[model samples]
Target: MQNMWKCMEDLDQYLTYVGGPAGALALTGVAAASAFYLASRPSPEAPLVPLDGQSILQNKDTPSGPEMIRVSKFYKEAKNGKFLSYFHEDTKTLYEGFRRGAKESNNGPCIGWREGPGKPYIWANYNETLLRAKNFGSGLVAHGLSPGTQTFVGIYAQNCPEWVITEQAVYCHSMVLVPLYDTLGPDSCSFIINQADISIVVCEDDKKANLLLDKSPKSLRKLVVVKEVRPATYQRAKNRGVDIVKFTDVELLGAQKDYPQTPPKAQDLCTVCYTSGTTGNPKGVMLTHENVMAALCSVMAQLGPHKPNKTDVLLSFLPLAHMLERCCENAVYMVGGAVGFFGGDIKNLADDMRALRPTVFPAVPRLLNRLFDRAQQEISGSCLKRTLFNMAMSAKESELKRGIVRKNSLWDKLVFRKIQEGMGGRLRLMVVGSAPLAGNVLTFARCALGCLIVEGYGQTECTAPVTLTVQGDHVPEHVGPPVPCNHIKLVDVPEMEYYATQGQGEICVKGSNVFKGYYKDPEKTRETIDSEGWHHTGDVGQWLPNGTLKIIDRRKHIFKLSQGEYIVPEKIENIYIRSQYVEQVFVYGESLKSCIVAIVVPDVDVVKCWALENKIPGTLSVLCNNPEVKQLILQDMVAWGKEAGLSSFEQIKDIYLHPDPFSVQNGLLTPTFKSKRPQIKSYFKPQLEDMYKILM
Candidate 1:
């Protein structure tokens, strides 16, 4: 006690020597703050809590001789000889689901859109939207579109009210909906039209209608223009014996007569979605009504408490032609949530978000990465701001570790409020899919946006999502357990040395959600789906200890170096693209070579900024030819590869900086934003050879 008093006396003397009572009080406050910060920080030794249920191994025999893995609910149900096919008992078809949603929400907003830039969204209530859908269906009947599963209705447009109306109309008439996008090009569009035997197509505008007429599909007999029909387009269509009519006129014609609704059976075909193939012709994935409903139910079941409600709003920007966007929109519609589409321009997405204030946001990794890069650039200008932002992120990350998400916390209010507001302040949930998001970007999005961000894994054949990250689970890399509708198992790829017993191999899925077959391609369908009904996804995945799935490599994209080491170019490209200097990258390797090389599309703004800082002068095209600029990007990519723990063979040995990006228009990238490997290699054959020669 006497010694403690002596220490206190010494402290008081030190405080007095430093300043006075004010200094003492300031030091005390600092000590308290430090203690609080330490307390709130996540413990280094704390165990990570598992976010998903345990995977139950099915004892049933499989073709590959490995036990299938399934979630407990599904395993139990299968064991009991029962399976879930729908979320709601009465919701058999998409049309029935929409009707149920309409009845539930009543006068609530169903779909909304903006008239022009900087304008508030105009909403159409559930009943009104349903009525319009009916009118449109009747109009189709008036135009000689027969109501049956055999009838195919093509919709070539971006996401708009008209697209949804057309889709619902097809559902109401028991017709198959075939979606087409401009990115697919005229040849592919014409092929789809002829393949589906489509007589009439709903075009977004005159350009699409004219493109269709120019292609002159053999089956096309009429053009239904959502926007005004141009005189030239009308004349061209008239010359081809194809009738051109406005969308409103079709609705008016339908309203004149009461067309009986012909809802499709559960097993009836719903859509023939064509994939954005990397090579050759695009394959049409035929999904039945049961297939789509099962996927929708599984997604909703996985969402659990975070499922969309009547009050929720989703911003529709991703192409409606893609199954991911289609499934997400259908999920929203199934629950009576409002969907507001973008203003047809990706540049204006932020403005649209601000106007819509969507509660639920579905995004792709490309956009999230851009947002992350923008935030980093903003903070790079000020060291003090950067330091505070880092501290705030650290605190939020600690809270996330404890499974807590807060939007009104002190750090959120001060540091992340602007980020939240930028994405529409009401955002409570975000679903990211279509590609694997960088772990750091995923973490930053969750922390900065202060919302439940989940990543899903799937493809067009599965009708959208197969697995989704669990809500309130902030772990980054792994896509969570399989949804209830499907059972997941890994098949050994002996050539790649990936073994199912070791929990690493090609992923295979079997469930109600699997598509019926590839449209008109029985051989391709048979190749994709094995005799046991398992769809062999070409993706290689590792089953994490927590029963989650981490995508490791793609079997189809895997190649080997001369040294006998296998390399996955997509994985390497994903790593290199993390470098701020890179915008898009195509990593190429020859089996005879010892190392890989890359064709990098440099980020123009970042490169210019770096050039200006270094006192270099050149336009982007000129800079692409500069040796120093190439070295700069190569060094940065190498650094990123090293940081990512990539092997020596995986590290890009050399790089060619290209000013022009690989895009759909250039035919070097697919419509889905995947690099068309053969085309890309052909396009840059000389550059690629030159880089290897320099390395030699």
Candidate 2:
């Protein structure tokens, strides 16, 4: 503290001493303010954003840890459901129906290869799945192979039993399962495999097999293919010295059932999920059984116990390749919960939701954002639609505001129940995570969907599940308390400077769920995990009085403007992308800017609709920059910006509505769907330069 004061004294020239002692006090205040400015600090109450930071602060702005813990105890006691528990002797015992039914998994809904939508009565607990995974794993180990001490096996398929089969088999046999994006190309797909020294790879279908087979890296030895992969595909692959084996061939060597082999220890490594690679090169995030167990415990501790007897059905949509889906997969297994796979491609989520409709669901903010955007667009483009929608929305919003948040509502019955029914009418808990969600989303999902909605904060490094908002803590943007036994701390982080002067700081976490370290990178591991065992999470966060953790943005993401104020682009982009016309947005203006700027990928349908209304020529995308088109988009941007109460400095000064969506094919985005800001800015410099030309 003395050192801080001495440093302040060195900047005495800027001090104003206008009224003697009062003046000196003012000067002290000025010094403190300067310190805050130098670090781009926001006080505890005012986070950089309202919904995210404000909601969190409401839950945690209490005096001390004990006080917050006390509040947590009260909430837990008040919660309607049972608390989640780790699998004990009692939980491990199989129910009579489940034990008998699991053995005939092949006859029930085949969740594996050649599967259709889902006959989920078979679920994740299918006896066939357990046998297949165990046989494949044990056989591989017995083949005189170490199986794997720390190798990466990338799973590049959609939601199928093969995905989990390969994962469970490998992990139970002491290998790390690396889930890859099904969209990655040969070069990028092989880059990480080579970098991580992966030798044996298990993938669904021959397409992925060919990727590994084509310009194959030398480090990889055996290529294991599942489902659609054929023996013929290996001919080209074998020329390159890669031993291509079938999943069936690999499974031929193990004990069937009734004679279960050794189980995986808690500390053995389990999975590795690649980082989004938005900022730089992709990294392989290695997780162990301990990490997976920790995340489950953390999540379960907070959500309370799952009532398997209640017959909960969880819909799996968001790519199973993601850590979020993987975590849910593992958790459901502990409770013997049924898992329903979403039908159709990613584009048909809404359509499929109406088809398979599970009891519980998990989604990213982008998915939830699309839902709201679609709802608004439905209401906007029509007159009668707008009137009815607005009436229902207003009533629903009012009930939410009045704390009457539950399943019984006339507005929901009339206007929103259809959406719920489309999702199979069994949604008990709708979980959202992986990004910051708007409070409005939480409120609407609760009121309209007639289910408990949850939001959480986590990273790939932590094996995904961390602090999650409990069911009853339905407040917007508030990520609920730390999972059962985990510890979350708000340290004075250097990353806090990027956010506006709302309360912000770096969030450090340590708990049963935190990772051991990065795979094969000790120096990097040491840098992230401090001596006291706390992981230095790069995120800046605020805590609400109720102990919900609200993440602002990454500490390293803070970029300065020419006017000297900081701008957190992530927060700004979330606001801009709320428009129905917008499909993707990338906000920039880090260094030389009086304010912020953005580039956008507008939806073709929305643009076409606008183009027709305005009688613009040359098609929607080509007409996007037409004087008429630009004017129309600009009006929406301006109106939306104002509605969010944003200052001009943070408003979008220019937009290039690219018709092209960022894809791995174009190298514009990471496989995880996060925009590569630097690449986008560097690629579109001309338009960016031209954008400021007229605005100034």
Candidate 3:
């Protein structure tokens, strides 16, 4: 604390020396204002209390341990009208599931999208989706698409009715669906198209179609334009032996022909989902119809008897290329629920939620964090509001401590009720996955949203979720017990010295949910999925006292310094991010370095407020590069590291403050929001070299 005061005094002296009394006065005023604002706002309630080595599951009489203990009974158990065995194993393919679902509720609303925020809505019933899917399949056949060949068909589009139709058509025609995220750049787009050997690509717009055509991979022999195609662009494609077809033209041709009678078998190829490639080139994850079915069905079994049905509505805004949203889409359809699309603009997502009035919401942690941040920001805007909000939060925290948070309380009516209405008052459950959520954020959301918020854990290889919090479970630290139909175990990671006996090691999974293998990479496949059929997830986890799994870090991401100090950058990064000053951060260390270096993206609002208080001269971007500002942030990080109880070597020895946050568009973040460490390191190589040289 003395050191911080000394630094501030030195900064003030330096500013006065540089620009006279005016500069010093500005710094003093800004600092005072920042201090006042921070002091006025109430601190957020702390993260949920830990289990204190007691097993919550055992205490509650829930089935305990690694969860595989009950796998056999759950797999074969026939309770109520549910199937006795694996029902998904009986379904030949996803197309069959869709066909059956469509048949059972032909008049039910299926797919829907809105033109814009508060704009007109569009929808298609189950019968219409089935009819269009049939037409789409026949249209593909008319274009010489051979069934049973497992040809690759790429869908480079967002979540829309057309994307759904294309997916169904791929399944109906016995072709493999390869999804391309809408945000993918040309290089990644080319790499995936060529890697997957995709012959036909369906794009959402002319811009995306043209971009793909520009890459013009040799395997891409046809292009289907879903929205609009100009004559000149069509002629250009035709000249290159690339058949250009309109989405409507394909449907018309399909209407003229009969839909194929034979659907792919259960074990046949379904989709080749490519990883977001945070490390290097993305690998194509080959999933069979059975694999997808198992994953979706496992989720259903985990949900118990109350599965989503026709009365439920879900808002789909996440990229379809990602496994979670894709699975959510299929699962909603499987349960015969209506799916609504976002209004395209992210800024209006809250409005979309209210407009759709969705009953179920499946989301990622980043989205959930944003929602929490927005709520807090609004509350902090006024003194009276902040006081009321703090009281409500305190009441909620008291309820959490007493294990009565799930019940209606006075705070709910006084505060949380309006918050819930903002998120479409009908929402019963919200599933969060794709990334670990901050426990405090999770706790606040459950209290604020007035709905059950379940955290799920899994990767694309397992289709979606491997472990999910049960409907009644509210523990925030653990992700929850492993879902039925899947078994998980921990194996010792010798290099990191993590052992299963100590309740920490690399997570390994085996079940119907695991993917077949990486497409065209038998060596990698063998490496990941052992002879025993257990897929080594490369994720580090520990068993909580409750027998639920808690992810600690990524095994592959751990690095050792020259002094043999093992460090998990992600773990450290998470700690640093807890500070309000940090927006995003990347920790870098190499074998030759005895200490770590960091690249940080400051929370602009926090930094700007601090800059004003310190009388720092410049805009937020300029302040990022100012030596004093940089040093101040470094000091803040050092203080945070101490607060987190990090080891000496784990502390950042030096840092480079980046003005811009890592993002997908800049290739420093994956579509899923995980940092692309290699890319980030490469992008800041010069800055890193400079820091190392200064230390030398």
Candidate 4:
């Protein structure tokens, strides 16, 4: 044991030395030897059978209906008349859950935030956070805000200590938390404020306060700013008959008086999360305490031995307004784990990661794709480095195929240590959700990071996760079986020629984790959740031979071309985006047109590299309009489509290269980074027409 430790220490020192000038040559020899040693190791132990799940038939009359799938444990529990519901029986509400976490953690670090760019994170212990939540809840009551499940409290902010504190405070008073973000737009905010009857809103700063004041909703009577409120903003609020106060002042007001806690019941509404609709006004998804608790239970079950504990630290950077991030933070808190907020700016995410060294990371495909691109770029810089990287990745991938995961292998030390260090050097598990991650990217991440990367699939309606890939599951294309909290089945989609009997159709979920309904729209609620209680997800899925689920297409994004063929734009976009030259893509087809067109946002770095190689000189915007550049990208995309087995009509007939990427700031993407297809089409209407005209 002592010799092993000494060897690891020596390897670390050698890796550090190799980064300097003199040791470069020596490092190449070391890397080659390490790769050879790794490849020569004896065959690993037999791979563990994936504990994905079993499928059971639910209907006898419907012979063609697909059987419902459930994890083995959940299936057994259901047969025994017992279901896993909450994290803890005693912790029925969010307030009680936090109190239990505080007790179990023994006043350990609960929430933390950085003071500034170069400063260390400041932590608030569990006891301190709980007390502050209590005080804040009391303050809300003192400010004439009702304290009950009927009262909705709005929180408009980025991920910060104040945001979690405000959420806990709302739970303490049994009130519903309605989170708002800038990407939802001003009209959506106004509609939500009026629909939910939110009387008080907690703003991150004076700017957010002014945004709410400008809306001037009838239900909004007061604003609580986390930061200092400018005099002008206060006067503006006053002119609108809305009272404005600092967040700290409210806490101080509650500190002088004691208020009894009003904890919510199991079925009480915990939050009203609004969805960023593609075409209509956002719908408020009402998730109950039981719903969220069930989701936590499901997450824990999915993690198994890898579930987070008090020692784990999560870096909270994804938008808290989204259910995925919110559920991730809540899961961390439930286990008494510490959560550190990222600096408001995303560019400083690396700095934050280095400072926090988070043990667990919850991410989205957009961010992971960027990391994958960066790693590829770094590896392709030199011949020797690229050779070593490929050798290391091959060795690690071999081990992964054998159900073995190791972060301290010889290859890890000789070749991939720098990649691990770039991500804080302590990431044990990474959960990817909110969008489908390409299989190649997932495989590369697992090999490079030397950690378990689990991909989950779900939406806000299901409290973030319907199914999560389990540990030791090496297959990257499928997102494992249904989670313990929910059972899933596929229903037929005749228009798309997808059928449950054929193991391909729309995904439907049913369980405690499902949201109650759309806040006040019974019609929409009925349209989503059928009478049988299964939430019909518009995403088309296929059941793989291994019993795992794979998302194949989207029903809502399908459009019929004039030739009487249906085109799934999102499906085509996913294929085209695999091209190195394409960063973002929007595929558009009109009912009156026989062919489809695409607007592509080329990856500037890769395109510029290509331009340099071809001796073509132009800026990104100029290159976007260059016919040769457009043809190069179109050819690459066509190749990708062909490789993916896309039909001829599904391939792009004409292409337009756009200089700018789709982004939330441009109202072309949701906060979760999903492209808003309708808005993207509208934004590029002229370009689409020009492409069609040229093609004609």
User: How accurate locally is residue 619 in candidate 2, as Cα lDDT from 0 to 100?
Assistant: 63
lDDT for predicted candidate 2 compared with the true structure: 0.58
Give the per-residue lDDT digits (tens) of candidate 2, residues 477-510.
6676655434555665532243223345667766
Better candidate number, 2 or 4, judged by TM-score: 4
Writing each residue's lDDT as its tens digit, candidate 1 over 1-696 gives 011111221232222211101101223444454466566553332222245543445554543366456553433474333345797778988988888788777768888899887999999988888889899999999999899989999998778899889999999989999988754667888999999999999988887888888889999998898888678888889999899888999999999986999988899999999874434577899999898888877877766677888889999877788777788888888888889988775546667888999999877665565566666766776665676677678878888887777676656656677778777889998888766777898999888888889888887888887788876567888888777778888888986789988889999988888998899999999999999898988989988887788888777986644332446677778888899999999999874455799999999999999999998899999999888899999999999999976756578888888898888998987889888887898999999999889875
Mind sharing the TM-score for model 2? Answer: 0.66
Q: Write down the TM-score of every candidate.
A: 0.77, 0.66, 0.71, 0.78
Name the lDDT of candidate 1: 0.78
The sequence of per-residue lDDT tens digits that candidate 4 reaches over residues 1-696 is 011111221232223311211112355576576756666665554322344443333342444335444342434464332345785679866677777777778889999999877789999999899888889989999998778888999999888888988999888889999999865657778889999988899989877787777779899998888888778887888899899888989898887876887889999999999985434678899999888888877877767778888889999877788787788888788878899987775545667778898989987665555556565666565766677777677878988887777667777776767667767889998888766677787888898787878888888899988888877778787777777788788888987789987889899988888999999999999999999898998888998877678887777986545332456787788899999999999999874455799999999999999999999999999999999999999999999998976657678988888898899999999999998886888889998999888875
Q: What tens-digit string does per-residue lDDT give for candidate 3 at 385-491?
A: 56556656765665555444342444554556666666677887787776667777788887776666777888788887778775545568678766665777788
Of candidate 2, the 10-residue stretch with the lowest lDDT total is 15-24
CA RMSD (A), model 4: 11.9
lDDT (CA) per prediction: 0.78, 0.58, 0.71, 0.78
Instruction: Flag regions of model 1 displaced more than 4 Å.
Output: 1-54, 60-64, 72-83, 558-696
Best candidate, TM-score: 4
How many steric overlaps does candidate 4 have? 0
Q: Report the candidate with higher TM-score, 1 versus 4.
A: 4
* Superposition TM-score, candidate 1 onto the true structure: 0.77
